[model samples]
Target: MRNLDLTTLRSFVAVAEQGGVTRAAAALNLTQSAVSMQLKRLEELLGQDLLDRSNRRIALTNSGELLLTYARRLVELNDEAVGRLTDDVYEGELILGAPYDVIYPVVPQVLKRFNALCPRVKVQLRSSTSLKLLESLRRGEVDLILTTEEAPGQGGETLTEMPLRWVGAQGGLSWKRKPLKLAFCNVCIFRAGVLRKLDDAGIEWEMAVDSDDDRSVEALISADLAVGALLEDSVPPQLEAIQSCGALPDLGIQKINMYGADSRKEVLGELADMLRQGFAASRGPVAVPKALTA
Candidate 1:
């Protein structure tokens, strides 16, 4: 009956995600009473109960679940519209997210160029694992993200498929008889694919080191502690691809992609073109830095 407020919808989504008033309050940086009052106001306006609050934990009612889905879409659309109108001057903040490995190699140059083109724009960068970055995107926290594509079910468009290669300290370890000393990120798609291939080949191997951080894995490989798989374009300067590994049986290559809410299609489209150009320029016929070459 009454027009819903955007702030109330945001609060509702936060509560749904956190599953309790206290937690939701903490996440939204609002007092528990304030959050509860907003939830109550939302339910009153909608003329239906959103959550079943009889229990300790908040459980979304069927209506709440439906509203939660629509609420996220609505918020995304609202934010995109606001950003577009405000961004005509290219003077507002653009929050971008990507894996450190991808961004560290060429993003500085990309940002430098982007800033020169849109000097008034303020750019903010956040680096994290692909999964975490995607979560941030869905939460409406990031304007755009660059990440590796997984199987078809995973969200995001496939921009480029670059080869994956095994790299380790130069001349430090030989793979003749020893099970390869492997280093990898815990949930890395590239690492998972590599491990799967190794299992299928019946290659005796053990994880000499594991971390969720890319820098840590790179450090291990650089120190000759273990071998690691990386995008052909992202191998570090201190390491060399292991010739014995022999092209890694394809590992299906790693895909780089861009993602944002559909409502931000205009902004995402412009951003995507810029990224495609950057990737092509970096990976094209012109030579890239040795650190970036496979």
Candidate 2:
């Protein structure tokens, strides 16, 4: 009988999530050569190659993808068991970062649940864009982050995915206006996708309002000051999805991700589980546009 080692599995998962052996080594506090050897050993044990080394960036083989799902769960369960056996009470400070606008309907409730589960654990939240949150994570400023990915499977572990659609005030013809007015955060990841889609479809647009404040952008959309692009599931009640906007291209699905720091695997894993459950439970009707589906 062959025994699968937890240490090797941890290295394999770190490589997959970090996107390279070098990054994984840094995160795992191991040498790059050691990390590579661990992966080789794991592959030999499984009798299959797990990674495609053809390109400069690492990508998972089909077998690799299949194992990743199980690997993550196994590692999580292993850590959870150890933590539960070692400590009945967990007390520590965790700094969490997230975009103010995207944290709703899920994050707040996740934090509430986390607090209840680990009453002595102190949590400090920092509101920032995904870009900034990732930087903070790297800088050791934030222990975990809930962030939005501009495209599906692009970055981070996706909690849920929703399409981006045009939105305008209910009963308003803002979408029909020429040089279609828009409002959004200047640093928003959706901004590039929104512009690229419009440009590719030969639709003219102008930025009418730009701010970091989500409420301001939503206000602009609500008052017919401009049309906006947002996740289908996140469209405001005062606004409606605009399906007939001329020649507008679909902004592909955006993923909400839960990213955690390299340390505190047990705590982060528990929080991640809670986040996934909370989002899964709260997910409402998806509002994909008809044309996009076609």
lDDT of each: 0.69, 0.75
- Model 1: per-residue lDDT, tens digit, 24-47? 565455788998899899998889
lDDT of candidate 1 vs native? 0.69
Off by over 4 Å in 1: 1-88, 104-106, 150-155, 245-250, 261-268, 288-294
How much is the lDDT of residue 131 in candidate 2? 79
Q: Model 1: what TM-score?
A: 0.61
- Candidates in order, TM-scores: namely 0.61, 0.62
lDDT of 1 at 141: 91
Question: Which candidate achieves the best TM-score against the true structure?
Answer: 2
